[model samples]
Target: MEAINISYRAMIILYALITVPVLICFFLKLGNVKQILIAVLRMTVQLAAMGLYLDFLFRFNNVWVNFGWVILMIAIANITVNRNSGLRTARMFLTVMLGLTISAFFVIVIFIFIAIRPEPFYDARYLIPISGMVIGNCMRANTIALERFYASIKKNEREFLTYLLMGATLREAALPYIRESVKSALAPHLATLATLGLVSLPGMMTGQILGGSTPIVAIKYQIGIMIAIFTAITVTTVLNLLLSLKVAFNEYSILKRDIFRN
Candidate 1:
């Protein structure tokens, strides 16, 4: 069965629902009604624009065009990760971009080629959405990992230095912080995975079901996507931190304060 479309009137009603929260915020003097309205407006405009662009992309479906869009997504995600992680964009851009691109494409290749294998192998429909999901997760995970890792070292500089002075190698000194950062980055996803179906339905599975796929098919796709997301996040987070070592620190094994955006 084809999914039902939402008419403009229906969509307007849905948008009207935002006022519920806005009213609550105003009554409580929370002072974020304006922010909420702006956020809703931005989301509406961005999704509308994206819908149009995605329509064109699906029709064009050229391999070069598809890969180009994926690259653009990766670039945007890379910039966002750096900005949110409080890292100087220019300093970590290339390294983090490399990590994200590698991990995202690695998982996408396996997921699309081996698992789904859509006809034409590079079908924009399958490739683009999967890439977006994987890259998006990588962006968030990398942000947490990078932010926590650097912040930990900066906050515990004396302790970090003590590890170094007491015969620890650079990697050895950074190991504890790395472990903590990776764990912090992965924890939310792990919890989500554990509570997935019991707590709430995931977007992919719900979308697939609404789009007319069998429940079994939707569940399988959701499982595949979740695995892909987790793998991409883990690889990108660790690879980003490891590759960044060359630029994040000096030859003398000192963490560079200048790398931070502040």
Candidate 2:
């Protein structure tokens, strides 16, 4: 397969395009100019670093190094999940990490190793990008699940306590929150799936076709990636939210208010 490369000078010019939106925001007084600028700047820097690292990783072709890189991505994602969920690093880090790593690895291995049977199981080319995509999606789902669950419980403390006082077990009392949280996390994906072909072209499928894969082959890969994404999101959200229950509550089965950041 041929590689598609872009020049660094082109990237700089592309980054400058962000200023158009920043100027528009300034004139309209929408108050998002700084935030938008910072976000674009950070995205540029982060993707640039990842691009350089990926170039080295593809060149090395070392199994252990590739595995190490995947683990590092997972760890960073784990931390991001906790932070985004408003959960403290001290309490929920390992559970989120374990849940995301386990769910992502299971799905990726089943798809890439057993199904696609990519030549080297740990090939950086396939393993790194695929695992990154899976972990990245799971991170978003888990964050939403965790945050919404805790936030709902806190916002409805009286109702939650009523359930407990009405002879509901901790698990029973928390089920409503669990259902709502999972729905909130997965609803966007469901909507995307429903309007997929009509609304927007999916990035993965577009990339595959642009890389010279046949339309049929690209469509199949797109279907496979979507299935993996949906499955991983469901598994990670449920598992992480379930695991978080252990640390999110007190002896009386009430969510602790102090767990949230101000």
Best lDDT among the predictions, by candidate number: 1
For model 2, how does the per-residue alpha-carbon lDDT over 1-262 read when each residue is reduced to its tens digit? 6437769899788878878888999999999988998888798799989989999999997999988888898889888887888878777878887888888988988888987887788888888888888888988888889889998898999999999999998989999999999999999889877777789787788898878888898888788888898899998998888888888899889897767765
lDDT of 1 by residue, 5-104 (tens): 9999998899888889999999999999899989998998999999998999999999999999999999999999999999999999999989999999
Clashes of each: 0, 0
Model 2 error, position 10 (Å): 5.0
Candidate models: Cα lDDT each: 0.95, 0.86
